[model samples]
Target: MPTQNQSLLDALNACVAACEHCATACLQEDDVKMMVGCIRLDRDCADICALTARFVARDSAHAQHLLKECAEICKACGDECEKHGAHMQHCQECAVACRRCEEACRAGLAA
Candidate 1:
């Protein structure tokens, strides 16, 4: 293992990938209308994750602030995904990925 911080970085990367994939999946669903909210949230969460990952990767001074915002976005996306989780496996996966990102963001905030 590269160590815990490295593991977190890896997880954050995974979350970003998950968010992007989920957004694409939402767009592909037969009932586009049903996934409107999910896709919107997925885009937002993915953007946040990408931005936050950049900050963390550079070990930026503003990482704390960015991570805080990332946590908030993740929470909102997670809640939205939870709503459609029963029917959409992608949404459920997104919810899990959002939670993971939230935890990683929070840890970054505390660092």
Candidate 2:
């Protein structure tokens, strides 16, 4: 992969990890029902990030399109996570990761 893709790839991977972690942690929370939305978005965000990373890794023709979709999902996931961040460390971390990934995706599109 080109050096230009490295940062985005790293961000994507980190977001995937963070989302997965967040989802798992949310499931174990005292009120799992309250975390349903966060859990759902975390899973969705992780899947999209993973897919986008694969597309970018291979320099796929559809990578740019995926990047745009990835950014949108990341933003949504980050926003959802942020809602619970005040009391959830996992959500806070996930939100930060999602934000970084969203910014990276936007930068990739700009490039």
Candidate 3:
């Protein structure tokens, strides 16, 4: 991994972890039905982040494209997570992580 890409990599990893945790926690919530969208977005965000991290780490030719897609997914996930942030600690944490990852992805694209 390039030295400059380290921050992006870190953000991707953190987002993946946060999304997975949020998804699991959402599944356990009493109102699981209402959390379906959040859980789905969390899972999607985690998958994209993980894949993007791999591409970025290897300096793949498609990294830029993945970064764009990752940013979009992260933004969506963050928005969804933010909806439940006031009542759910997991969602709050996930929202923060997703926002950071989204910023990192945008930065990576700019670079």
lDDT of each: 0.82, 0.98, 0.98
TM-score on alpha carbons, each prediction: 0.89, 0.98, 0.98
**Which tens-of-lDDT digit does each residue in 18-43 have in candidate 2?**
99999999999999999999999999
- Badly placed stretches (over 4 Å) of model 3 are none
Cα lDDT tens digits, model 1, 1-111, are 236557567667777787788889888889989888878888888887788778777777887888898889889989998998899898898899889888877876776
Ranking by TM-score: 2, 3, 1
- How far residue 8's Cα lies from its native spot in candidate 3, in Å, is 0.4
Candidate 1 lowest-lDDT run of ten: 1-10
Flag clash pairs in model 2.
none
For candidate 3, the 10 contiguous residues with the lowest summed lDDT are: 1-10
